[model samples]
Target: MVRTMNKCDETTVLNAIATCRFASASDAELLDAWTRDQLAEAFATLVNRYSVMVLSVCRRKCRCVSDAEDAYQTTFLLLAKNSAKIRHADRLAGWLHRVAQRSAVATLNRTAHMSEPDESLGEMVVIDNPLDEIAARHEAIILDEELAAMPERYRAVLVMQVYQGDPIETMAERFQTTVGTIRGRLQRGKKMLADRLRRRGVVPLIAISASMTTQVSSVEAASAASQLLGMLESSSIPPSPPLSESLLNPLLVNGRNLMSPWNLGCGAAIAGAIGVLLMGPAEGLVGASGGDTVDVVMAQKADADSEAAAVQFPAVKPADLSSVKTKQGSVAKVEKVDDPEVSELAIRLKGELDRVSDVSIDGTVESLADELQQQLGLPVLLDKRALAFAKLSPEQMLNFDSSQEPLRTSLRKLLDPLGMKATIENEGIVITANPSQLVHLGIGTDRWLSVDDETMRLFTEKLSESLKLQFIESPLRQVVSQLHESLGVNLMIDHRALDDIGVDDDFPVNYSLGGEVAAYDAIQMTLRSYDLELTVRNNVLLVTTMEGAEESLLSRIYWLEGLALDGNFDSLTQLIQTTIKPDQWEALGGRGTIGIGPGERPSIIVNQTYDIHRQIESLIDTLRSNSFHPQSKDTGAHKSTPARFGNPASGFGGGFGGGFGGAGGFMN
Candidate 1:
């Protein structure tokens, strides 16, 4: 009877393993001699134990419910395939997590088609006996209340630890942060949880026992663990969180679709003008080929070179002696001997000439023509033989054409040069001229006067000082102010644009609040000011300001627009009204001043696209300023995925170049 009981227990354990594959090293040796049917039974045991956890991981990381389901199945499939290579059962949970994570990321990169968070969950389902289920259901309500109320960072740490049961090391690894940081997060998370429970009139059990390495020891943490188990165990757990939304759903949609509300609205209209005629499913809108556009613009400029000869000046005419003003104060004949294109006859008068100060001297037709030809160094044929008999050349016979008055007027200036007698005091007054020579200097012509080397050096110093003063009165101050406001977060704003010259970094602006605050705090304050609350997690920013504040998701949308277009308040408002779902508006702080709902979260997820959109919009603005049209989809080709052993990971989309992953630093 004892032997039979032992056999029964063994059989039960083996049956569980077949269902879940949750077996340790001891089971490995037994499985070595087991048939295929026995191995399958062992795998099943492991599955039954951890399937719930695996599904949760999949939902958290994947694009859609279907995707998550697929991922869960795939993980099991992989386990079955690699049964022979099984090593330790204790690591199975971690291995399963890795598999799911990879699957989620892979699916997102390949086809990012996740729906928005389920709206159905927002409306409470009617239960037949509400009072009977109230006790068990109340816990879920409390948990939700606590979670929704907690700071985003703390909540994130709690979720990862409690619901996911992820090891501290794994959390640290996932966030690409240190164990110390994870510990810090866990400690703070525990305190916040305790505080929240106290607020609910529940005396929270909270303690931190010392552990050897990076490990958290809290009674509340343990309680949280038990609550999680309870929630998972009961499929009908009241107020179960809507299925986890996609990680990539906040950025890209399936194919060329951009997940942002504003993108959907405007992207449709500007498809053609932005270079892509249509934004079809597979063939998303693409701008005019960049290479072709560049070539066409260059070719247009190159075509103008053929017209240069038409503008070339005719051969210089000899001075007509008949018009020479011989009564001169000084005949200071200046000569340029290099090419001798034309000879200057500077016959300065005693004072400024009466009507037309400059004059051209007419000489003997023949000798003048010869001198003109010799000076031009080009052969010219003269029409007059009498002029030729005096050794005249063809170049000298070239006369100014007055067919076009403007051309005639401009050409006449070459023959009739300005003349003046040198005064004793003005012996070396440098000639004033305007040339494109100073373009090589960094200053642009629009904002700066291009001067010669001597003038530029002197002007740069003076201009630099003037700019310093002007910067103080400039709108750049407002830009910086708006930047802080638009980010909805506190930043170490580097006010060094004119700091060294005009304002120091410490010099407070009108809106400056003396000291810095955490970005989360600042974001919270900003959202509250707009009657909203922001919630942040792993780069996801959720606006959970109120029940009515769900409408403020519209404002959050405005924040996105503001961020994209450098705080254009008008655009921000318009985008909000256009992009947000009507129901979500109530969840965001709606149209009031600093409204707060029960358990409002200040900031939840950190939206990375806020930065990306800002950059793209900045680029668009720059392109417009430079008179170059920008394409709509600035995102490059290639999607983001993990690296395989044989093939390096490659981006596979038409957007930001970087792949999807942790920030790989504390800063993320």
Candidate 2:
């Protein structure tokens, strides 16, 4: 979340919030939370800004008052639920109008499931005028529906003239068009709306069919919501949120000194809003309990769920995970049992691994493995992949002893004799027998990386930065530099690799992607045709060929233990190995190897290029998030699933174009 409140204070939010200080505070702008207080404040401003328009929309479509309240709450609560996905701040009205109407419909649908409906919630007016047989609220709903779909260029003019009460001449100045153009657009937009309403079999009301000759004021007597529809600053309103803040509140006046209790009450409301909206892993944890701390906890949980919903992973079958290798260096075996004893075995294993005590060892690799499992009570085994590389067998003798240290440290010492290390994978201990002969394994160095590295820490942040550009046949260097500028990363071209691959720095490129794309994926997408990939060295991003990346392999271990409990661990590793960079894994004639860890929660030891490692990290992080919040069937069409790159292919369907895409330029 952003922190726009940092620039201004409560005094500004309560008093002179009308000046240029907040002139550009769009709905998207106020959705950030650099600090917890900013999230509270920005959300408060958004609620106060849009409550009227949203309420009016809700009141129009929902027949029951309770349904209206539910719709209203859902509209705002969903806004807070998917705050990060609000890419179009200027069209906040359009977004709200659509969502508010959809929410009203959803609430009505939900009410249909009730044993009995409340008939007294709202009563429809029976007007006397023949031309106005339907209530004005009904008419507004029909017109608003048509207006929402119209191009902003045309519908915006109509809204300015009708809703905000801007004159034709004034609108021309704001739109940078002539008075005649404004009037023509206004008349044409109205006629189109009238035609649409007619096609829907909605009988004409003078308020809808009349041309520019009729003013919105003429229908004031017919509409119950007429005052709110037209240009009228509310004398007073409760501080709340919905849609159409700036669109309806053109003057932006009457900034109130929100009472101290307002924050407390709003905090409760905001907390309840999220609690009612989010599901999945956060199913029963959300609460409306009073406290700033609860707000932070609930909001953070919601944000994580939101991110989980944002990333999409392909479906994999459970059987696909069956028949893989079981705990350490055991031969490939089919795992076929529920094993009611799993919890007990897991506790025993944890106790063995966590024990900090003296230990001694002297035996063959087979004997060492046996000691780890049968004696120490750890579910230990060896990985054949690592052993195959090291050309070592379980019969090989090994020796080591330890004093008052973790069992894990002693296990490493035992494996250290040969170039292998131990990891917990596949619900047991996996002794990964990697080549210890090489001083550099593309790990924990400028050539390789660990999670502790600053660059590694910034991996998620840098990849999440959006990149959009439109250039026809631009030089490769120019495109690379442009991406560097957009992503704010230390991106550089690998000239040697480019030359070795017989590609030129000025290779003419004709590509256009006008939609949501993270910079990491964007780099891969633009360079895919040349067989290029990204790698890191000295904490700097390097663009190199897939061949260059393979020359110097790095090894990193991923603990997928708790992350993939919802699905098969082996299938997850297979998904990563096969799809992330299909050609690079050892199975595909490349240097990379993904060895399954043993335990209930699975893990994987990967030896690949750094860039590929980063991609794996993104995938696991996304999957972990989405596991908490499986997508909902109720709001399928309107669910906020913004494009966030996890798998390398997240950008596949996003390559749409009419103009330069903007994140910095819109498929989404």
Candidate 3:
């Protein structure tokens, strides 16, 4: 006999099912009633009958409670949207189960990188039958695999019928066919899906019954059904324009409303009044017109002068125009005002610095700069006196392999040989002879090399290549200085912060580098013991203390449960203390804390950088994995001690003891 359970009066439910003729009705009959007639009661009955099984499958496949709920909602929403396409009502349960699992897996994959567990959705009821749960989960997996392997059209039809709950008539309209054609497609789709599953050494079946009862609240099921129905109704309406694109288009600003005629008329009236006031009376216009014209001309010139003064070029130095002379022996006019065309050209060139090109420089700096200017569509300024002094020969060719390098890097390589540098200053890239002067001019220092994460990783890998080097407790400061000198890169250290951390500049560090050990590895090994690390910030090598580095790191909280600690809070607290170490925990200045309750589970709170937190999390996982199980025979004696308050051994229900209790106490 077909039976169903609801979280309402059993008698009432049976009576309602019998009165509605749903007691012996197949899934297809209910689906047809709901889809064709918009029967809300029929839809509610279907949701109540299947939500438990769908949620059970979702919880088994999902990693978190929120994901399970999300999958559950998505499964029903899909069904509601495509209620008309279901041909085989008997297979609806199996189809929904598979879809729920797929949705859950997708959600888990999307949130895999998120550290903190989601607590937004209500908790799922724990399943008691482990074997049954495993079987259901396995069946769902087989269905998912088979569904994935099906042809696109077959899968779409199957999803519409089973997952989306689309009526056959609606789907026929959607696919531009008759209801019989849609039904044929559904039958073929299900058969193909089953065949694929059988080929994979498994047979798909509706092992879990839709009639199986669950403790899931009827109110929740009814609510979900109502929402699904609303969604179905809303989906029939035409979609509005995208907010982002609509806002960007000036003519379509604020969705269909532009500058109204009223606004335009008001603006015109205001303009007319302002003109009348400015021109004075019309009777005196001829006499005062000439003076007014002169006044307007003077006003425009003053406004132009003010605008020019406001355009300040911080990178350009205030040098005499006579100092710069062209090859023709005449002083070149340097406009004090900012040139809009030159500014626009410079912006474009800066954006295209990563463009690949083949450049062959076979002449003097003057000729090379001129060629680059014409090729790149930007001005390339070179000091005339400096270029003349170098006196480059035509045969002194510099062929740049820019295919693998950016334009900026190639330009730097070309200029460095002449004891000069090419810097992107305001309106142009200026070639300066004095490297130090470039810094003062605010050109070189402001344009640090921008490296992506992948490039930096490769750089570190290269630096880690094995090198033979040895240092016997050498002062870290001296070692860093030597390494920086060898690498020809700037290394900065916070000497004051180091002193505060009790690390002197002359503090000794030991390292022995040989074989394939890279210089980068050696440096890291030396700093490892001193609680120091190397970080690249703003394109500069920074050597700082671990504590100092934590300032820039993100803070996260983690919850751990089912630790099987036998309610022994003292042992748990001691274990955590030993794992993290008292000195290290204290050094965090209350940023990290552990809380043990009078239960098996405990919580750990850590405030550190993401990298450091990952290390701590790994340690905790190891401890949890190695923890003694309460169910084991050897732990029977420990389990007998009833959980109570104020027990020193239990570490709860009374006064605080040692370890975490003495440090920060248990967190509720």
Candidate 4:
């Protein structure tokens, strides 16, 4: 069979997958355009959205280029014809993926006799014949289907994190679980998936899953072009194929499946050549289905910026927590706040601290810490970082005779000289640098190298890479274009936001770097001159005017349920407002806002910048950790705790204290 049509440059497809913004149009938006059939670029935009994924599958399933091309076209054609019939827009990837799988299968069955087996080509590994290829493809498809059929919480977490590239933390919030739980579920879920694969006489294709996920996850949501024109083009497309098979899910995966039957016999040939891909190389080993012993093998560095062998994100073991923790601190928005409110628990804790105890610090501060923890009946943990900042150490002498003084007063006298303050978190009393002092720790120090936008993992990867950039007083457009080209990332500027800063395309940007610096810092440095901040909205990064990211606000509720059990939330709100970014508060003539959440247990709600928000979370958590609590192991759950929180925020309750809407936002 003679190959027809052009093969989309595999490199372009890969690059597009990594940094291409599906024209910043939602699948629904893109489909709407494709259905309208007005603009000449509609088909192009729609094709670009899933082209990488479709072609990836086609490349594996088809024996020859011509067959793969036909199959790829047929897959999109089905989407084009049935664009209007798609009900679940969010799962468009999943739906299209399944469709592509089937289309490839169907296309192969139709042309099985046309081509005489296959040889080596493209990025795929060599296969001796089509039969072996079929078996491997069979495993991958079965794996996909079985994975789809598993419990959603597990399946969702796996796919979103591993497959689609959503961060585990994002998945936690989406699934409303803890970070630990998300990781735990991934292990359990992977085990279950592996078991099913093994039961089917196939070794788990987890390595393949990981590799694929890593690749797709690297794709950033922010895309290329004029914001309006890009949107318009994405929504407009060429005529679609006749609406035949829309979303055909025989096993029913992802959102209200519309079942459709196929007339052709199930193809005997699977993409057997993909056995190399499915089985991987002779040397690579991802962790077992169990969680532990996950290895962090550095991937072979890409030969160039465009090398396919370059796995920027390889399947690292969960044991490689340093990177994950780094991301948690930088890549992900770290809400360091766990509000320790003033309530019955707080009062009890205060009482404990305030109790006059026969205690004396005659030895090292470590001895005093031990006595305090035992005497106050609260866990004593030291914040080493805070201790360092305060210029104190556990070995240092904190000599004091508090035989008649309250623990609170005694502890205060010892720490005051060191610029240390004690706060009660749910866990125990924590000795750390005073909050007033720590605020200075984060002030004017936000690099934002990794925080926000999971879809931008690849973009974030680019942002973190060191580059020697030089631009001599270039126009903003020129600056944006050059950076986009260098970083290979789509840079979308919010013109309206620029207008807020009285800046425009012609705004002169002077950025010069003689040495290699992270692109993230570089971009921030470039935009900082014009008071611009980056934000992700509608799955696209927006170069907003210096309102934060200033204007971008993420709201989180601090559940001080245990501490707030019997106290007014007002004071807690005040503590947060006064301590963290005081000037940023709306009450203090800043854009930030904080308030009491009206719930059975008092909850504090605040809207702030990712930076300040992180501070607030830290502040709350610190307070809760040091705060004292009265507890009984046999005590039943508290009725005061709201049901949604499910677990107690502290010692007193089972769920939420309460929550409110209209959270605060940030201004850069």
Worst 10-residue lDDT window, candidate 3: 292-301
TM-score per candidate, chains pooled? 0.25, 0.28, 0.23, 0.28
Q: For residues 380-410, write the lDDT of model 3, one tens digit per residue.
A: 7765554433343433555544444556556
Off by over 4 Å in 4: 1-46, 111-113, 120-123, 126-166, 169-192, 205-255, 258-668
lDDT of 2 by residue, 236-348 (tens): 32234333342222212221111222232344554443333333242112122222210000000122222111122122234632333224332222223343322333323
For candidate 2, the lDDT comes to 0.47
Better of 2 and 3 by lDDT: 2
lDDT: the better of candidates 1 and 3? 3
Least lDDT summed over 10 consecutive residues: which range in candidate 4?
A: 659-668
Where does candidate 2 have its weakest 10-residue lDDT segment? Answer: 658-667
Per-residue CA lDDT of candidate 4, range 424-524, in tens? 43344556554222223331111232334345456656767987877787887887777778877677787775554344678566788778887777777
Q: Which runs in model 1 stand beyond 4 Å of their true positions?
A: 1-49, 54-75, 78-159, 165-170, 173-177, 183-614, 617-668
Give the distance in Å from residue 362's predicted Cα in candidate 2 to where it truly belongs.
9.7
lDDT (Cα, tens digit) per residue for candidate 1, span 1-668: 44555533454454444544433323333334332554434444455445655554554455455565556665555554444454533234444544545455555665445676443222123345656233333443344345434434455566556555668777655554445445655664565566556656644432111000112123322322233333333433223222232432232121121223334455444433333212212211222232221100000011221100001112122342223222333222221222222112211110111112222224443343343334322222223432222233434433332322221122223222211001100111111111111111211112111113333233223222311111123243353354445454332322322222232333322223345554434444443332233422222234332322222222111001001121122332333333333112222212221121111001111111122222233333332333221111111111111222112112111011111110000000
* lDDT, candidate 2, at 444: 18
Q: Give all candidates' CA lDDT scores.
A: 0.31, 0.47, 0.45, 0.47
Model 1 lDDT-worst window of ten: 293-302
**Steric overlap count per candidate:** 66, 27, 22, 46
What is the C-alpha RMSD, rounded to one decimal, of candidate 1? 24.6
